[model samples]
Each structure stands twice: as structure tokens, then as C-alpha cells.
Target: MQLVFEVCEVADGNPVSTVRKVFDGVGGVIGRGSGCDWVIHDPSRLLSSHHGLVGCREGRYFLTDISSNGIGMAGSCERLRKGQARLIEDGDVFELGALSIRARLMEPVQPFGEQPVITGVPIPDDAFLALDPLQALDLEHQRQSTSDELEALSAGVGEPGAWADRHAADREQVAMPRRVEPANELPRVDSGALASPSDDVFWMEFAAALGLDLGKLDHVARKALAIKVARLFRLEVERLQHNRAYEEQVRLISTLHSDYPG
Candidate 1:
């Protein structure tokens, strides 16, 4: 079975270098000798290593404080104390300073009707038979006694006392909600002053009846129309000025010509 492992931090946007150093340390432990095929280490890029060798082994995966600071796996069942060998299982999370690495166990597939055989592995004869039942029972009794004591301590805690009530009252007296004034609304514009619907409707209907071909109207035509409109407006203003000047000149010339008549 190929295992999948991921390394991330509690804080977002951690540097790639920190992630790499973690993989390097993990690689050193499981990447030696024949285990090279079962371990991978790279931190520069994600998906850097392929195959099933990027994670740590179950029994062999151990944590150490090689870093200048220290590393810890928060919320772990085994309680990974400083420089301790905490056995890693599938879905186990370990924190190395800010870095957090999660392990996922992959299930191994077996062929049908094939009874699995355990061979050549170190096995001690009478390993299970060597247990002392009386000693085991004593340890179990001690565990139960400890659990009962914890429950009793938890049940004793109840509502706050007089001191807590006084503190709460003091805190309430110090703070109060401020008043929020109403905001001034903007004055509305008069709808009657705006252009009427009839004005727009007439122009729209006239434009529709003309069947204006928008595609046929290119940049040149638009430019030409704009120039013509500007020129016409300028000519009308010029014509008014010219008429006024001509009227003044004619009045003066008539007066002069009349005065000098032979």
C-alpha cells in the first residue's frame, strides 16, 4: 500500500524552506539503505516526490529537536514530549515548531482466498504465554481508581461565587452603549425638471423608422457626422455675428453717402 503524507502549518503562508527542512529530517531516518525506495524528501515544491515513500514509518518514525528551537506534535494521543519517540499512525498530526505534518495510512490489498503468511520475521516462542495475569489486573485496578478521582474533581466545579459576581458587576458598571444619531438624508431631485418620456419616445420612434444600419456606420461616417454638426453650429453663430456687423456698416455708409450726395 502506498501512503500519502502532507506537511502544512497552523499559520497560513509559511515559507517553503521550513517545509523542506522537515522533509529532509524525515528522509534521513527512513531514506537509508533499502528503505530509500520507501522514503522521499523535498521541500522546494509541492508534489516534489512521487511513489509511496514520502512519509514516515509506523514504528520507526521518530521526532527530534534538530532545529535551533524545538518541534512538537500538538493534540497527539501518544503525547510527544521533547525529544521523544512517538509512534506515528495513519491520520496522526505532529507539529514541528510552526510546521504540522499529517500521515495517512493506505490500506494494503490482498488476493482472494490467499491466507497471509508471516515468515522469516523475528518471533519469540512463548512470547504471549510469558504474561503474568495477576500483575496485569493490579495495573488495570490502578487506572480505574485514577479515572474515578478525575471525575469527582470535575463534578465539584459549579456556578460562580460572590467574588465572581462582584467582578461581573464592576465590569458592567464601567461600560455602556453609546447613543447613535440619525443620519441626514440627501434631497431628492425633481422628476418634472428631467427630460420627459415623450421627448425620448419621439426620437426613438423616428430612429427606428429610418432603419439605421449600425454596421454600415463606420468610424469615418461617425467622425464626418460629428464634424458636420460642429461646423453647422459654428456657422450659425458666425452668420448671426456677420449680420450684426453688416447692419452697423450699412447704417454708417448710408449716412456718409447721403451727406456727400452731388
Candidate 2:
């Protein structure tokens, strides 16, 4: 199942910029922070870093207010306080911080979007063989010689695992893959900062928090999860950048970390 959240910036009773995100299974977070999927830039500082959540359960979509200031539901007299969740319907309008968002229910069919068609040149028959019989024989002999040489080299290398172990030191000498890096490379947040993009540890922490087994997920699932994580990271980064105070930044990290059950 999939759910769509069409978020629009409201200014003077008029809509400004709009962002649309389609969430799968687990749904996503809404906030002023960089780590949220639906990020609202609240200049009035009326929203929490991690404000609310929109998720689906048992085919029913619900909205949960996790923000300190609470969330306003359209046609409702009172605000939905922290920890309060309500079943929401399609076309429902809700207020978070300075922005307004509309909820939309979607069917599972073709939820993500249409895939591109990839066409390739077809290989012709006898493409690999030389046109002349004598030249073909010569080419066959050259291929055999190369195969034999590769087999000999393979035998000398012993088992693949053993060869890898032997060259471990040499591999270490090479530059690290451009993924995880030292915490120092990230924005300062007291003792540590939120992990930057491509950081393994940061992603691991996020996966753990979401009760996700990344190793068990297929490529498509992983890609979706990565997109969600990127949104969250962006939300957090925005929060840190918006709030220059060191103590406030540290508190923000502590708040988010403490909120995670895992």
C-alpha cells in the first residue's frame, strides 16, 4: 500500500511551494528538521524539529502528532496533542508549523511511478566468429591460450578467500570507499553530529531505529528506504543549520535520540 502527502507552504491564505511524497508500508516523518520526509521550513519557529508522523495501519491511514506545539486538524476545534493519533481520510487537510498538508490514499498498483523502457541493439548471429574459416581457427586458438593462462593463474592464487586474506594489508593501503567518514566531517552537535550522507554507521542507526533489517531487503526495498533516510538527514541538517546555538543543537540531537525506542 502507498500513501501520498501533498505539502504546500501557506502564506497569507495562499499556497506557495508544494512538495509531494509517496510513502510506502511504514510511512514517514514530518518535521522542520532535516531528517523528516515532509520537511516544513518554519521561520516562525512554531514547529518542533520532529513534529508528526503519517502512517498506514491495517489499510487505515492515521496521523500522529509528536510535536511540542501540537497539530491542528481541519474543522477540528482543538489541536491534536503529543502522542495523540487519529485516523485520517483522503483529502484531509492538516496544519503543521507554518505549512499545510493534504493527505491522499493510493492503491498499491504502480505506486512508485512508471519505469523507463530500455532498448538495446540486438547481437547478430556469428558476431563472435571471424568471417573466414582460417581466421576463426586462429581466433579459437587464441581464446584457448588465454583460458589456459587464466586457469594457471587461478591455481597459483589458491582459494579466493585465502587470496583475499593475503592481500588484506594491500587493500587497506588503498583509499576508503566514499561512504562513512569520521564524525569530525559532519556538522558539530556537541560531542557528535548526525552522520553525513553515505555514512554506514548513521544508516545502520536509522535502520535499527525503524526496526528494519536492511540485509534482508532487496534492491528496490533498499532504494526506497535510502530515499526516506535521505529526507530525514536533510531535515536534521536543516534544524542544525537553522539553530546556531550550541546548547540548542545538542538538545535537538538528545531529543531525537531519546525519542527513538531502539
Candidate 3:
């Protein structure tokens, strides 16, 4: 099974909320305890070091409460009692004291001993956008991992610079402004103006959204993320185009219905 964690907000610590991590493991821990798999470094006294345990077994995933203070689900104020294990559903939000996290079951596990096959299905750009923004950025980074120096401004915007969780200190500066803070709040974008798909301004804004500063990176480092930036831009442009096309079609249908009356 594919599991995804989106850090929606960071009430404390580094801005890890900008990150999205996917795992295909059998099980793991999410707590502040030293032995826990996912260690949380928060100053809140409400959280137990070992707050929760997560495991995939018997063909299903589950989360068990092991904290004394209790973990509360966002929509419901009900706090799970200690040793209460519940099946994890898609889009489940849990509040571990001050740290808030959302878990999603991304994909079901394929039965073992069965050969996997590729259907050659063409996935739409919107499908990717449905993913967590950080996840989308990461996938684009992987796809462009081997890209060399950029031949176009649209070619980059990734690499280890502004968006990268880990950035080198001495790379040449091409610093883009720091637009986003926590990374969860996306800024309003004018898709029509970004139709070029190869514009520097478009890429700069995108990198900013991803928590990357284009102006802070050195010339060499900026060249590194060229492909990913362009890829994200292209995807966004296509999504916008698709949206516009759909709107136009709807308007035309409405006009025809009014004038022709079926």
C-alpha cells in the first residue's frame, strides 16, 4: 500500500509542513519518543514521546493510541483512548497535541505473487495536481534528476536551492523572493498570464510557492533545478488550459439550451 503524509501546519519547529513523504513500508511509528520511527521534536508538554503506533497488517492499515494526553481528530473533538486501534481511512486528520498531521491511503496493495503489468494509460495533468503539492514537486524532481545545465528558463526551478530541504550555502545567487512562509497557503495565480510555460517569472513564482528562493541560489545551483521548475510550470499550464476549455464548453452548452430549447 502507498501511504502519504502531508504536514499541513507546523505550530512549532522547522517548517516541515512544506514536506510530503510517501512510504510503502509495512509499519512505522509516529511519536516524539527516542525509539519511535517518526520522531517529532516539539516543545509541547502535552505530547507523549510515544504517542502513536502505525502498522499495516491483515491486508489493512491501522493506528493505535499510546499516549496519555490522547490524540484528537480534527473534525471530531473525540480523543482516542490509550490502546485504541482504528482503521486508517483516506484523508484522516490527527492532532498530536500541538503537531497536526494528515494521513492518506494513496494506493491499495496489489496481491502478492501476481505479476504487475503496465497498461500504458495516459494520465492527465490534473491527476498529478490532486497529489500534495510537495509530493508533486518531488516527483517532478525525480523525473528531472539527471537534467544538466538549463537551455531555457522554463527548463528549471528545482534542484537543491530554495525548495530543497537541504541547500548548499555557497552556490551562486539567483535568489528569488521569499513569497511563501509555511508552504500550505498557496498564493492566487493568474494562469492565463503563465501560458508561455517557459517564462522566468512563472518559474520564479512557482519556486517561491515550493519554498525555494531563486535569487538565493548561485548561478550554478540555479542551473541545477531548471528542468523541475519547467515541468511544474508545464503541468500547471495544462491544468489551467483544461479548466478554461471545460468552462467554455459549459457556457456554450448553456447558451444552446436557452436558444434551441432542446
User: Highest lDDT: which candidate?
Assistant: 2
Query: Per-residue alpha-carbon lDDT of model 2 for 1-262, expressed as tens digits?
Result: 5678877546445443336777776656777666676676666777687888765555566778877678887667767766656777878888876667787887877535585668797744544433467766765575577777676665434223444566678879999769765675665463223434655565567665554445544445666777876676676576567666877889989999999956
Which residue pairs clash within candidate 1?
38-53, 73-95
State the lDDT of candidate 1 residue by residue for 150-238, as single tens digits: 75665323223443454567777886778989679887765433646874564345323322222333444534544643554465466
Ranking the candidates on TM-score from highest down gives 2, 3, 1
Enumerate residue pairs that collide in model 2.
33-235, 34-234, 34-235, 34-236, 35-232, 35-235, 35-236, 36-232
For model 3 the local lDDT of residue 6 reads 71
Candidate 1: segments with Cα more than 4 A from true spot = 1-3, 10-12, 15-60, 76-79, 107-262
Every candidate's lDDT: 0.45, 0.66, 0.63
lDDT of 3 by residue, 140-178 (tens): 786677455442444445333333422344344658677
Candidate 1: minimum summed lDDT over ten consecutive residues — where? Answer: 46-55
- TM, every model: 0.24, 0.43, 0.38
Ranking by lDDT: 2, 3, 1
Question: Candidate 1 lDDT (Cα, whole model)?
Answer: 0.45
Q: Give the TM-score of candidate 2.
A: 0.43
